[model samples]
Target chain A: MTEKPLLLLSNDDGFDSKGLKELIETLRPMADLIVVAPSGPRSGSSGAITSQVPLRCSLVSEEPGVTVYKCSGTPVDCVKLALNSFVPRMPDMVIGGINHGDNSSVNVHYSGTMGVVIEGCLKGIPSVGFSLCNHAPDADFSATLPYVRRIVANVLAEGLPVGVCLNVNFPDVPDLKGVKVCRQTDGVWASEFAERKHPHGDVYYWMTGVYVNNEPDAPDTDHWALDHGYVAITPTQIDMTAYGQLKRINDWNWNL
Target chain B: MTEKPLLLLSNDDGFDSKGLKELIETLRPMADLIVVAPSGPRSGSSGAITSQVPLRCSLVSEEPGVTVYKCSGTPVDCVKLALNSFVPRMPDMVIGGINHGDNSSVNVHYSGTMGVVIEGCLKGIPSVGFSLCNHAPDADFSATLPYVRRIVANVLAEGLPVGVCLNVNFPDVPDLKGVKVCRQTDGVWASEFAERKHPHGDVYYWMTGVYVNNEPDAPDTDHWALDHGYVAITPTQIDMTAYGQLKRINDWNWNL
Candidate 1:
């Protein structure tokens, strides 16, 4: 008999959120699972690590094919802790999210969900992050199950390339319109702060923004795919090097 | 005069750190500067933003050529706030760091210093992040001054390509060799946790690890440049798409 493939799981919305619960339910039967997730919400944490303080992790539950731990750190911290101390062996896959909100386009750079997958990818693991377009804690995730299962199965069958991971987003509609392999849309968040006066007569700001798509007509972009009701799968990479600009920068007159 | 070329600056090491002070002193004569940085240290805060709570920003001082503000948020948040409400006019360039520590190789993925420049690049501005290999609170930054002046002047004169920013690292030496345009070295942090037993008998962990360079002999990488006492300048981009693997993933049997 063959041992089941081990899957390591985490999320930005904490371990008890509906998104992670649904993910655990969906993948538990297919693999021996170990989940190390933040004890509280850590949205928009990007790749933050808690080096200022020691981390506390406790086993939340352990059943036949699954074990879960809650960590007092960011999503990336959970991944590091799990790989360094928690997992019984190297996981076959490192999966993040079923995040409560979409992580498409420029949002990828600011996502704690993506942080988990990026950390895993950096450690040479095949990784993927999943997100729903809806931000509500009780948002329906039934529409994402089949696609998630299929994607997981395919990745398990054919491992991802080195330094590459997947960022998958599902539209909010209950019924899906298939999947589209897409690129990150060129976009920026505009009008990102709402000003308010504090009770002490000081001005404060809250972050709230509308995304401005630079290429709204591009059908190959993740934003367009989500808008068209398709599940978007963007293959994200860890190498941030701008190879195209390297030569241009090399020609600069460095008078030092 | 071309309005002295407005420059916006920020750093991850808090607004009052020696690194940021030196940066301000170096560039004060070259440009009209606005500095908005974190109120306290936010190391390893990679692109993280504050959405959970309202942010408070207070102006610290305003001189003839420089103005400084302290913000209760991450490095990325400071950039957003400055761009949206603080800057008197659109900045000619955005600069981050003169960081107390190096943000080379995989460190860029977790450096809040890099987060500042990445935010600027996404907003379609010429941006650059500068770092010194030394992490000391009072590290000697004299060696980096000339390079900073030249690089900033270069970027100001010739704007960066859309979606590209620079991550420049200076070695800790007093006398530096000439600058080297390099790629991010392939690397990962290994043995990342130091476990400890709590007084209450619970196991906890602290983050501390050694970076394992996957390609140490590669002379064209930032790691190599730093090791040889050269200023390494790496062009970084906001686009995370694995363009090389998109076709490969498209060929996958994503039968959903």
Candidate 2:
């Protein structure tokens, strides 16, 4: 009989988040688990690596088949530390989050959860990022377990293509309408910062934004699926190349 | 007489880098400029947005058609602050970097330079990120001026497509072979952390890596263009969706 697959887990909401705990409870028995996650919440850390300062990691817990470590870095840093140094061997799969907030639409580019998944994909490993639409610290992930298990199993059974990973976002509903493979909705964050005056008379700004979905009615988009109460599974790639514009750019006479 | 174009500028290497200085020197006389950049070096920050902490900005310099503010945030945050609060109006163009190092191939995904550009594109604005292959604190950018001027002129004359921007990397060589619009090359950083022991016995790791280009001979790739002494201009997009894998994923029987 084959041994259980080794799985690496990480999240952006820190190692102590309810989402990470839920993921561990759901997947721990199914796979040999090694978790290396940020010591604190690192939301909006998109594929950031900590190069300015040295990173420190401490082993917090260890079991027969599960080991967890907290690292002083971003989500991508956790994945890098695991893959490059901590893991005994390259894991069969890398899973990030069951994140506290949705990583759909333009959030995919700003998500630390997706950052971990992207790092995994770059290393030629099958990777998946799971996020819930709810942003509360106490958000319940009970509704997402079955879908998560099924998707994780499917990914393990069918490894992803090169340079691609799955970004699965579950709606914050008690009853799910099932899973839909969808495309990223065209969207942008109408970002604004709220300014406040400090006691010292200095002004500080808190980053805030509202996501505006441009294709709200598009059935094939992840945004639509979530709005319709379904789990949205979007296959994401690391290549940012605009293949459609390449020909036109080539036609530009740079020589002149 | 046409009004002078309003330009927004930023960089990952702090407000004091020579690259940023050169950019100001090159573009200042031609356009109205609003510069919002990190107050300190923020390399490897990628597209990170500072959300947990309140950001502070101090006006460093203000002159007719040229104003500069230093922000305590990531590169993306600088652009966000500029667009959302600092700038009186959305600028005609956003320019990032003249970075201290190359942001070619897979580096684009982890670049603070490209982070600013990506943010601009998401906001439906024309954007460009310029990088030099040299990583010195005082790298000679003289060789890059002609190419930079030409590319910036073209971008100003002809705005980029919707949801698209430019990732332009210059070879460090003094001699030039002109420019090539190419695709991002397939590459991964073989990262390793150098472990060290503190004087008090705590362990820390410094992040380091070597980029390995898998397709070194592909003439169509940005890496090849850079290697052959050409300034590589890759038209980058904000979309991370893997359209090629969509149909196959949709066919997956998730119902089971």
Candidate 3:
């Protein structure tokens, strides 16, 4: 355990993504880094699997303590294949995505980026998802790497609890004030499809959205952290128990 | 609102699945049921989109109060098309699956059935995913109907809080047992690929798993409830925050 922990890295933005390159560059110096990620963009592919068909993984790079593979599958697929046979052993930690865009608040549910991290946490492994609040393919990640490496080092040193991981998002800014330990903001993406006509005049809609964060004034929220130029770290877990609604839903389902 | 609601139903198990049929039959009496599941099995398709090309949704059936559309896309796609234009107005309740499998515990992360529910929750619509712990194509859903209907009724009577939905699971058993409103069990699917050689001698790994609930004896868990023939209602939310570890992670991310 004292050895440089074998850290598995992945992302939704695919293997050649700038985010992955940045992540690999940052973490490669710290520990044994095993990078396995989708070869093509798998954004919004929330934990999907190509179950009916066979999937493939192409070896991309390797060094003494660094190895990378690009998978023709979802982000979770990369994690699974790595866990199954790609890695020399079970990874000490799994870090997904210095993501090309933010996966804060409700975005985590649809994020292929966070899906791999959640996959790792499901097995009780420490995991973290790093995201920058910039969507461009060549988004500004310089401001994000220092925080990503720092969080990874800390998690590696002080292991996360079973089923727990961190969803870290940074504001796309030059002068980050500090970091904020915040909760997921209460927000929802109202996806409005951009309707268009094809050559044959058939109508189709491209899915697009404006994220609507209803509760913005909440002091310690991921949205607030990003707004204030602080790295937002929301320690997330796979605990889906709606503690608030358990007894409230008793009237119908339980009475049966 | 007082009208018998427009119910959009789907499942990952294909349109012709027994679970889908049962669910449609169950909902027909209560609501204007619009069934828009995938054309073929989409068991592992989480939140994928057909952005590379245009997709199709063909009308399969049109009855008095029930209509079905077989879509060539993921569960989220079906919901998107419906929410965008296929339906007159947004569905009142979006129910994904009286699924032929359990989506309790960590399976939530891998479920296309639950993916639709989460999308519905994001859109501020009440959603529920009812799953039976049965994976057979001809699994009997008779045992699960009452609880399913009850939960649906309760949700309609009192809508879920925005961004939350009910993930209901039933044990594949005979006769009656009570329901348990519980927390997500600390469990994972220990998956191993069934490596098979094709006629062309290419080896492919088919995903298969064994459910390993580490907290088997924990009474308040979904796993325990399902094991005891009690229908387990896990009120799942999209926010994955483990609030206790936030400050620690924040400080760690900032220190570097």
Candidate 4:
């Protein structure tokens, strides 16, 4: 008999968030799980790492086939600490999220959920992050479970290409239409701050924005897929090199 | 006669760091400058945003051609805030760093320095991030001044592509070999934590690691250029899509 595959799980939402708890409940039967997640919400942390302070990781809960640890760090830091100190052996797969908010389109750039998977991919591990297009505290993920199982199973069976990980975003609907393999949508967040006068007569600002899609009509993009009630999976890579522009930049005069 | 170009400047190191001051001094003669940087060091912040807290921004210093503001936010936040609320108009270019440490190889994934430029690129602005391969508080940036000037001049005259930015790294040397337009090196940080016993008999960790380069012999990578004492300019993009793997993922039996 072979031992079940070991899966390392984390999320940008705190360890106790409904999204993460739902993920743990769904994945429990498939693998031996070691969950090291931030003790508090760390949304929008992106690929941030804690360097200036010593991190505290405590084993919060332990049960048959499941062990959970809460770390005082960002999602990326949790992944790093888990790989280096917590896991008993190299896990077969690294999974992030079942995030409480949408991580579609350019949100990946500002996502702590995606940060976990990116760190895992950098370590040459097969990684995937899942997000729902909902921000409700008790967002229903029931419709996403079967699709999640299928995708996870496929990734585990086939493995991902080196330097590539999956960014899967489920639309906030009662039922999913289907899954679409799509590219990241070209987009930007516009008018991103709200100015306010503090009680002390000082001006402060709140970070807020409206996403502006540059390619709204592109059916092959994540944004379009999600808008059509489909699960959008973008194969994200760690390399950010603009290879097409390298030659153009090289042609610039460099003589100083 | 054309008006002098406007440049928005920021850095991961706090507003008063020598690196930022050096950048300001060098570019003072070339254009009007507005500097918005974190009030405290925010290394390894990546694209993290400060949504949990209301950010305080203060105008700290004003001079003939230079104005500096310090904000209680990450490097990415500085760029967003500058564009949304601070700048008189969309700046001609957004520039980050003259950082105190290297941001080559996979360091870009965890770099607040690169976050500034990445945010700028997403906003469709020409952006560039500069980093020195030294961590000393008083690191010498004098040798890089001429090269910096040339690169800025070229970029101002010939704007970058819509979705691209530059990540430029200068080696810590008295004389530079030259410039190299390169790709990001494939690398990962290994053994990333040092376990320590807290005084209260609990385990804690300090994040530290050695970079492992997968392709040490790749002459066309940013890592190689930095190692060879050349100024490495890697054209970076905001798009994280793995286009080559799209067809491969689509071929998977995704039927659920």
The most accurate candidate by lDDT is 1
Q: Give the alpha-carbon lDDT of every model.
A: 0.95, 0.92, 0.83, 0.94
**Which residue runs of candidate 3 sit more than 4 Å off their true CA positions?**
A251-256, B47-52, B197-203, B251-253
Summing lDDT over every window of 10 consecutive residues in candidate 3 chain B, give the lowest-scoring window. Answer: B247-256
Cα misplacement distance, residue B48 of candidate 3 (Å): 4.3
What number of clashing residue pairs does each candidate have, in the order they appear? 0, 0, 0, 0
**Segments of candidate 1 deviating more than 4 angstroms:** none
Stronger candidate by TM-score (3 vs 4): 4
Tens digits of per-residue lDDT, candidate 1, A30-149, equal 999999999999999999998989999999999998999999999999999999999999999999999999999999999999999999999999999999999999999999999999
**Models, CA RMSD each:** 0.8, 1.1, 2.2, 0.8
Query: What is the per-residue lDDT of model 3 for residues B29-123, given as tens digits with 9 covering 90 to 100?
Result: 88898888889888877655555455667789999988899888788888877787678677889999978888898888888899888878877
Q: List the residue pairs that clash in candidate 1.
A: none
Worst 10 contiguous positions by lDDT, candidate 4 chain A: A100-109
lDDT of 2 by residue, B91-134 (tens): 99999988999999999988999999999999898999999999
lDDT of 1 at B209: 96
* Worst 10-residue lDDT window, candidate 3 chain A: A247-256
lDDT of 2 by residue, A1-256 (tens): 9789999999999999999999999998789999999999999999888988999999989999899999999999999999888999889999999899999999988899999999999989999999999999999999999888888888888789999999999999999999888899899888568899999999999998888999888999999999999999999998889988888877775753
Cα lDDT tens digits, model 1, B17-91, are: 998999999999999999999999999999999999999999999999899999999999999999999999999
Q: How big is the positional error of residue A58 in model 2, measured in Å on the Cα after superposition?
A: 0.9
TM-score of each: 0.99, 0.98, 0.94, 0.99
Which pairs in model 2 have colliding backbones? none
Per-residue lDDT, model 3, residue A107, is 80
DockQ of 2: 0.78
Ranking by lDDT: 1, 4, 2, 3
Clashing pairs in 4: none
